[model samples]
Target: MDGIFDMLILGAGPAGISAALTAHARGRSALVLSSDPMNTPLARAPRIDNYPGLPGMSGRELLAAMGESLEEQGISRVTGRATAVAPFGGTFMVSAEQDVYRARTLILAVGAQQGAKPFPGEAELLGRGVSYCATCDGMLYRGKRVAVLGLGAAGEKDAAFLERVGCQVLYLGPTQAKKCEIKGTDRVTGLVADGEEYPVEGVFILRDTVAASVLLPGLAMEGGHITVGADMAASVPGVFAAGDCTGRPYQIARAVGQGNIAALAADAYMRKEQEKQK
Candidate 1:
């Protein structure tokens, strides 16, 4: 529990920034974790006119301003594609880039653009033969044949770990055809990529993120979006969700407002817990 942060936010866009700022303002230590090419959908937008006080600013420009605000607020941002999140001892442990960080509460401002569907049977075989964290599960498949589907740099790094762990690794880059299907009856025996078959014992689908439900196991979701209440609290206690991951509209202002609400809710949750301890 040492070095645990009060709040760990998992995005750098409007929603994440808003949440970090709010948590900081409320005297909570916060860190924003995100992967490279952060906030891509917003970063690539040509222009955003609807956001108040920043009319005509491109997504890049708006993000720059937000970055400055974060610096002024003393919020540290980290670049890592978190692949797993789990609850432990009433806190959360986030696994990313072969490292783990712990937080008392979490704010999920990650966008909804979770890339690529899982290969068939991948979800079912999770923990059976499919995995996301090589650092966590690579040893289980050590000295065995495994397939690494690298969706981001983390995948490449993890693949190397798999190799070092004595596994026969099949490294597949992101550019490889998106057509991947996991093959097995009870456990992953192989996979099919771009209509080609691979005889392997396991598959590691390394991406910037696993779905919220996959990350926490019990996070209630609807229509592929994380379900949140009026306060932006997810079905999972001690966690709040906002931004595009929550659902429709997907506007910058909506995301920001929801982020603010989520942060406020998170702050209150932490306060209540602290009081309980006292």
Candidate 2:
């Protein structure tokens, strides 16, 4: 396959970065794929307060440190969402909207998205009155009172999309009190702050991410998690899973640990393939 990576790690957080660094250190071509607002959970943590060495450091600080390490390692970064991974000939290709990245081995470090705070009607009316992806279901509430339940870029974009569709869009997020940078009127309503609720026919949770499911197929997902084997391989071969996307115990250190192990396994698998060729 053309434009294939020897190893392509999805997500830019701790796990993805760690795996890319390790693969690079081993002299394997590696690329990290991530979307915007890269910090994710680390950016939201009130403070680190834990995780060794940086006892008092904030989560954002730790995240920055890790990001710096990846940069120092000369690891390449691709800003795109992984929509799916499929076996292509003898290698794997991670698909995004713009292009398809090939990798003999893949590391799914795409971390779990941040949890959503459901309002009174948010959960009760799911599908009926709530949604997560505007791209997926924006047309459902055309010309209706639809609220975007997030303040991040994704939320803002969703609001814009809804507004374009002639839906009454309300912007809501963690910092909804702050004046919004996104501009729209008529179909788009202003934001509703954190402590308040808005009367909308539907609330879309667009908190800063492209849903991971959009990228992978046949994923063993249960409640927004992909199952991984002991070696961190998903049910699929030549593919490994790590970090929060693998499920609970969503800690930076744990993600780093999983990334390291997954890299080793991928490396070993590649070596075996080379030997088989001989």
Candidate 3:
């Protein structure tokens, strides 16, 4: 809904919140983009016993604390899942459901892996009839049959919207999302639902967290994690990564430390770029 920001952190968990706090401290404006905490792994962590001074706290407590810190610092936030990211004119444009945000620098703090591995044929068919955001691509499928694969209410909403847009919608719930497979060649031919085939021209995937690779294409990854250097700089020049999304030792402390590094690194990068222009 807003225009542009100095930085856009793609999670509200430890790493994300930490990055936003650090960026704001360094005089950089940042926006936190995240889905509902109640649906994330952090919210389900039974107990966190090793977070330095904040030991033996429940997962929800730690999440709440981070949120409070972000708000106290006056950093703005958007509660939604980012479906895709595009690098344009040296800036990154992130598509989160119905909203699009642009930022000079990007931070990937999406905790851990999300959603099941992309459905078979899903990647190859992406943008070739398979899409992640309904509002972004629904118009392309107008008057055609399409299948909606999603894990939450968001999926149903997207399906309904498609119907309103003139597309015949096949609404598959979360249980079906886990079992269905994408069927297509040059494009999305259809979807195989629970062993039954339903022909469609498009498929929309609605998940709380889309895969990191899907978010920013060609984002270097190591062992299923975003690859980053000592500076927390991601392979993408204007992008940085932190926390579990970057690798192992998935601890709150690790996430917080990395988040801080990412924020500082992003600020430094922007400053260096400004110098280049001068």
Which candidate leads in TM-score? 3
Off by over 4 Å in 3: 1-3, 139-143, 160-167, 193-195
* Candidate 2 positional error at 23, Å: 0.7
Model 1 Cα lDDT, one tens digit per residue, 1-278: 36999989988888999999998898889989987634467888889999999889999889889888999988988887777788999999998857889999999888886573566787788878998878888999988999999986577888998999999999998988488889898899989999999999989888776777777778898988989999999998999999999998889999899989998999899889989999
TM-scores, all candidates, are 0.86, 0.68, 0.90
TM-score of 1: 0.86
The regions of model 2 sitting more than 4 angstroms off are 37-39, 114-152, 158-207, 210-214
lDDT of 2 by residue, 1-278 (tens): 25667888888888888888888878888888887534477777867765777777776777788888888888888776554467888888776644778889889887886542233433334455555567767888898887776645666776888899889876666565342222123332322444454555666766545344544556566677768888888777788888998888888889988998888888888899889999
lDDT of all predictions: 0.86, 0.71, 0.88
Pick the winner on TM-score between candidates 1 and 3: 3
Q: What would the per-residue lDDT of candidate 3 be over residues 1-278, giving only the tens digit for each residue? A: 34679999999989999999999999998999988866778788888888878878889988998899988888999888888899998899998877889999999999887554578888788889988888889999999999988675478878888999999988888886667788888998989878899999998887778788877889888778999999999999999999999888888899999999999999999999999999
Ranking of all candidate structures by their lDDT, best first: 3, 1, 2
Report how far off residue 195 is in candidate 1 (Å).
Answer: 4.6
**TM-score-better candidate, 1 vs 2:** 1
* Candidate 3 CA-lDDT value: 0.88
In model 1, the Cα lDDT at residue 65 comes to 93
